[model samples]
Target: MKRLLPLLAVFAPAPAFAHAFLKSAEPSVGAVVATPPAQLLLTYTEGLEVPFCTVTVAGPDGAQVQTAKPQPVPGHENELAVPMHITAPGKYVVTWHALSQDTHKTQGSFSFTVSP
Candidate 1:
């Protein structure tokens, strides 16, 4: 039994290192602004696969804005940028989903407001 215990420990599954998270943003979370930002930027903790990752923006009325597709920033695997065209807004939510190099997927969201 003692010899078998040692073998079992060796075969035990290790904990998975989860995909990266949103470390920060440009306008910042829950920020209120007088005018809309020309571009939105998101920074993550680890590199993300561009093909399987996406960032979306929704207006205060829960309607999605026709924003530009997310693009990877130069020399930074953990940063992404998206263009914006916000007309009228009260609260805007930014949602993101990303897949890591290990094929694990993760998602999260944040919101900010545009003052009238």
Candidate 2:
């Protein structure tokens, strides 16, 4: 039993060092909205280090559309928002990199559309 206990401990999950994975978004992944969104909101599976995280939005033409850097949502430690200035009707790609409070890093990208 003692030998097995050590082995189990070695294989146990490390919840304290988990990455901050994307849990949801405002416009949502692959959503089609009639109007452009004023901002992009992202929720993560864990709290983020706001200063070490970044979210970027690019228009269909490949130009950057986000007006500013990502900021943490008030009172929400696991959420971040990016102000947007998009007008054209097309697909927009949002990419994000997160550094969790425990120092684990994660990143991913998704796209949404603005219909004319």
Candidate 3:
């Protein structure tokens, strides 16, 4: 019974490590489209604390196209939207970094193609 008590104590707080993950996106990744999207949206599995997220768009030639800042969606703690102004036709990569409510930082990238 003594050994079992120690094992139970160790497993008591095992649920605190649940990490956040990307849940969805607007103009979804790898999507090919004919027109430029007004904004880029990213949704997370969990709510962010500070909501300091950034999204950068790079054109096919590796040149940045959009410079607008990312804005957090009102009433939605796990979603963010960033304005876009894509001028060239090619592959564009959207990279994002966000801090979760637990003070853990997460980042990832996705790509989409703009038809010429």
Per-candidate local distance difference test: 0.84, 0.94, 0.81
lDDT per residue for candidate 1 within 23-69, as digits (tens), equals 89977889998888888888887888877888899997888773778
Q: By the lDDT metric, which is better: model 1 or model 2?
A: 2
Per TM-score, the best of the predicted structures is: 2
35-57, model 3: which lDDT tens digit per residue? 98888888888887534766788
Segments of candidate 2 deviating more than 4 angstroms: 1-17
Candidate 2 weakest lDDT stretch, 10 residues? 12-21
Alpha-carbon shift of residue 27 in model 3 (angstroms): 1.1
Model 3 Cα RMSD, 1 decimal: 4.5
Indicate which candidate wins on lDDT: 2
Error (Å) of candidate 1 at residue 68 is: 1.9
Per-candidate TM vs. native?
Answer: 0.79, 0.86, 0.79
Q: Which pairs clash (backbone N, Cα, C closer than 3 Å) in model 3?
A: none
